[model samples]
Target chain A: MLLQASNLTIGYGNHIVQHHLNLVAEVGDLICLTGLNGSGKSTLLRTLAGLQKSLGGHITFRGKDVGKLTNEERAKLFALVLTDNIAVENLTIHDLVAMGRLPYTGWSGNLSANDEKIVKESLAQVNLLHKSESLICEVSDGEKQRGVIAKALAQDTPLVLLDEPTAHLDLPNRIEIMLLLRRLSVHTRKTFILSTHELDLALQMADKIWLMGNDGVQVGVPEDLMLTGKFQETFGSTAFRFDETDGHCKINHLLGTLTVAVTGESPATLWLERALFRCGISVVPNADIVIEAHQGCFRLQNQEVHSIEEVLHHLLC
Target chain B: MNRTYKNGLLFTGLLIVATIVFACDIVFGNVRLPLSALWSDDVLYREIIYNFRLPKALTAVVTGAAISVAGLIMQTLFRNPLAGPYVLGVSSGASLGVAVYLLAGSLLPIAFVQSGWGLVISAVIGAVLVLLMVLGISFRVRQAVSLLIVGIMFGQIAGSLVTILQNNSNPDSLKLFVVWTFGSLSAVSWTYMQVLVPLVVLGLFLTFFIQKSLNGLLLGENYARGLGINIGRTRLLIIISVALLAGTTTAFTGPIAFIGMAVPHLVRGLFRTSDHRITIPGSILCGATLLLLCDLATQLPADGYTLPINAISALVGAPIIIWIILKNK
Candidate 1:
């Protein structure tokens, strides 16, 4: 195992947030940790990174107790990509990434030729080498995040822990970051433990899921966790329901005044049902009002409606 | 790579400017001695050049470099652009010590407290006391800005205490205290430099040793610790170094301001980088040049009367800082 935690308790001061946890991460495993707000995700990541003291138990990496390792030793073992806002002025992307070699560099932090090569390679890995000379403030948010990840990559540690790496990104940027991490884990053969709220992406990409909830942490493969109802148990609520079939947590709509039958090809019907459900209309079989959703139009009671808006107008009116 | 080359050229240019300013400070005092007078056989001219002008010039260079470096360290440690050497009340603490020693002459042995060493010792004690309090509070305060506010509060408390002392002081001592508050670089002779130079050099050396950790801190404390930096130890080192540099300079110069608060910003604007490896040396050189120029302005040939060093520094530094703010904005 690359890392193992047994009977670990994590919290601040005397208050315990989590306890009696046993977790293992093997080489090349992309473990996605998902939890609701205030579920101790950040605390667990901090504890695992050895940045914070665990309340009890031990974390060992490669059979060595992590807490016992010196700071430099631990730095060589774990690299981190934090979600903290870095608004540093005048520091260029290269300068920021070059800092990752500080653990191995001399006291002056003068990067050697080898260290320079690594920094460049890390920047190139993130496709940020083109903007390496640009000041951090001049970069886009997604580019800045990529620079942070490049810094971690330059650190060259076997284990990388990212806390909400996609928190401040748009959808495409979020998917790109997740895909980048997946590719890095596969090619570099390094273990990754990242906490994210992107459940669908996590379900599709992660090798293992550490689902933290009020009851404790449930650890398993994503499909197994979904099949066994762990995701539902953790995330399902009165306002929303976790759809295990598609691995989506959808809002639970109330029963409406009208029940209509929605029939068409898949995907269009799926979206039409969602739209009808959101408008307080229930989709059922053998109803007075029937709607057929197609590629560009919908057939509603033998009238062709060009849009969901017109269909909703006919039904609601 | 290209930026390093440009910075190297900039460092050399600043060095040349500092040297020119240092020479000007030594040569262009009220007496207006020529550059060739150094080799002259006139006893009075030799006395002015070696005894008075040289020490004052050297003091200006040292004071400026030490205080500005302290300011840079504080700004990085607190992560506040407004943080300066005196922001933590070390100067106020030093001033309070001097005020008590000078104003309370009737309560204590006049001869002992009147000595130069006695004043320095008292000021250092006051500074260390405040530094200890600030350091203790730092462990409990997680936010940098909170510590800054606490320091400001401590400064206000010390200032009020000094006011009370002044009200009770005799006229002779009151006059002396007032002059000391105006700040002077000319008061530090070679005897005091023996103590001041080594301490400031030690502080500067300690700063160089932690340059890497200081750069790590640019990313903030959590990210720095993740890079294998010991946050507590780094903080302790920074606080101690600032105390040594700012405290000793304040004790000698009677709380010179503006240079500490402004020089780092000047260097940052000039170099356009916060990388400590460049800023540390850059601050040292730029600070020395700026102060030398300020001191020279104070001593413009005018019937042997000179402006207060504090007034001159503020006059020169405030505009530069304002320019930096507007330009960066």
Candidate 2:
């Protein structure tokens, strides 16, 4: 096990977030902790990363007390990428990433050649080599996020923890970052535990999902979660429906499957299925609305609709 | 360690140069003496050099080095570009002491015979009192903003009282207050230097031990703790260094202006780095050199009556600040 929190009771200044939370993540495992805002998702990540003090219980990493190690030693074991934007102004990407090598450096903060090599490699791994000379403040949001990840990779630690790494990203950027993290975990054999609101994306990619909902905390693979009905319970909410089959979240289907209307000029093959569905009809593989007017739509697979003349003929006959 | 060692070596070189400058400034003043006559201990040259010039030069060198180091520690501890000896109003409180002793005549019984000694003692007391107030406030408020406002308020309160005392002083003592306000380096006797130099050296050595801790502090107090720095003690230690340096310099030199605030700012710009390993020692050298230049320029006896040292510093200091603004823009 790379890290395990033993019944850790965590809180700040009289308010407690969670209690009796126990979980173990192994090497090369990508885990996601998902919950609503203020549901202790970030708190659990902070507790495991040793950034926040555990009020009652303790966290152990590799059978050693996380609290017992010296600060620099713990830094060698785990690196965290918090939600805050990097504070340092005007430092280049290379300079920003090199701070991860500070623990290995001497007290004077000078870097060795090996440390320099690691920093360069980490920057390249983040696909940021071309941007290494640019200032952090000059980069876009996605680039800045990658720069932070590069900083963590520069640490060369076995365990990396991030809080909401994909919170502010758009769709393509979000998938790209999650995939990058997945690739990093596989390539380096390091464990990554990131708290993300992107449950469907995480469910598809992660080795295990540490679900933190109204209940304390649970650890299991996405398939195990489905069999145990934990996946539905964990992400089940008032406004959204979790489609476990396709591993996606969609707006809740109200009266009938919330049908989409197709009204474009061509696309006739797909258009008939869409018109049927728009008028409060469901799409079935071999049962409802037989196919006609097949030129308008191309991608709508197995649904059919009636022509205006057929409706009139049925009424007259 | 090698870099710190090299920095120490550089410090020794600057100390030597400062000592030579001190001797030259003292031995060559307004009155030019025949070499043979001066060497034979001529009455006029001998009195001027021994009684007046030597004390004055020593004060400038020592105060420059001490306050510059203080500014370095202040900037590091607060992680602020503008932190300085006077920004905390540590010197204003000392001025209050000078006001009480010279203008108010409140310590006549204690000073007894030496009129000047009363002012120095009271000034030291006043500065230390303000130091305690700052230290006490720092514990409750960690943000630089609150501490800065608290310091400014302390200075304003002290300044108002000093003005009141100044309005009531007699002519002879009023001259003393006026001279002190303009700031002269000739107030410290050799006896005072014996008391001050060792303390400054000790404080500076202590600073070297915590150089890494100070660097960690640059990240913020929480980050420093995450790096295992004992935050409370480190903060107390910084306060002690600033207080000792500021208190001692203001005690004898009467709050030498511009050097404390401007020297650290100028040094950082010159070095193009913020790492204290270079910044602290660099400030010392730059500060001492600038003050020596200012002190020399103050000797415009070419006009038959020289300008005050503080006036000369303000003249030089203002242009540099304007240049800094222009260059940054």
Measured against the native two-chain assembly using Cα atoms, what DockQ does each of the candidate structures obtain, in the order listed?
Answer: 0.72, 0.21
lDDT of 1 by residue, B1-329 (tens): 67879999999999999999998888898888889886888999889988999999999999999999999999998888878899889989998998888898667776887678878888898888898999999999877778899999999999999999999889998998888888999999899999999999999999999999999999998889899998888999999999989999888988877888799998887898899999999999988998899998898758588999998898988888788789878
lDDT of each: 0.90, 0.73
CA lDDT of B244 in candidate 2? 78
Model 1 chain A: weakest 10-residue lDDT segment is A236-245
Interface RMSD of each: 0.8, 3.3
Highest DockQ among the candidates is held by which one? 1
- Fill in the DockQ of model 1: 0.72
The DockQ-based CAPRI class assigned to model 1 is: medium
* Candidate 2 off by > 4 Å: A45-52, A68-73, A83-98, A101-156, A164-180, A197-205, A222-237, A252-317, B1-58, B100-117, B137-181, B300-329
